[model samples]
Target: MVQDAASGDVVAAGTSGEKKPGFFARIVIFFRQVIAELRKVVTPTRSELLKFTAVVLGFVVVMMALVYGLDYLFSWVTTVVFGVPA
Candidate 1:
């Protein structure tokens, strides 16, 4: 729905019978939109990038340690129950 900004009335952008833009026109519009969006992007500083990378790596290491501990505990329990080690 399209709105009449000053009148505060809702309106359709186009009628159902109205033809849409052709393929080349659509491609041009797509690239225009992509460029507009890319213009809005902000790059992080080197320090901020380093901090983010370190935070991600630290999280991964903590997850690995937790998984290893749980796996070892389960393996020990299994060996005791089966009277055999893999």
Candidate 2:
């Protein structure tokens, strides 16, 4: 038996009693489910979107700075160990 998550209702009794849907019916069902799920999505408000974008950009900038510092540190370490390349 399959239980519906959203409504907390039993959707199917048992697989033994029911015949499987045909290929086209299955396709239709899949599209219907996709549409249903899409309907549940919440769109961010303009302010919320801007805030999220700013946060993401800030995070990326911080990550880039960290990587750049690491690369610079490694380069310096290699230079010190190997002596300056000719």
lDDT tens digits by residue: candidate 1, 5-31: 668887676743456678998799889
Query: Which stretches of candidate 2 lie above 4 Å from their native place?
Result: 1-14
Worst 10 residues of 1 by lDDT: 11-20
Q: TM-score for each prediction? A: 0.70, 0.81
For each candidate, what is the lDDT?
Answer: 0.86, 0.88
Q: What is the C-alpha RMSD of each candidate to the true structure, in Å?
A: 3.6, 3.4
Model 1: residue 81 alpha-carbon error in angstroms: 2.0
Q: Could you give me the TM-score of model 1 versus the true structure?
A: 0.70
| Candidate closest to the true structure, highest TM-score | 2
> Tens digit of lDDT per residue, candidate 2, span 1-86?
55556688877645346666789998998899999999999999999999999999999999999999999999999999998968
Candidate 1 colliding pairs? none
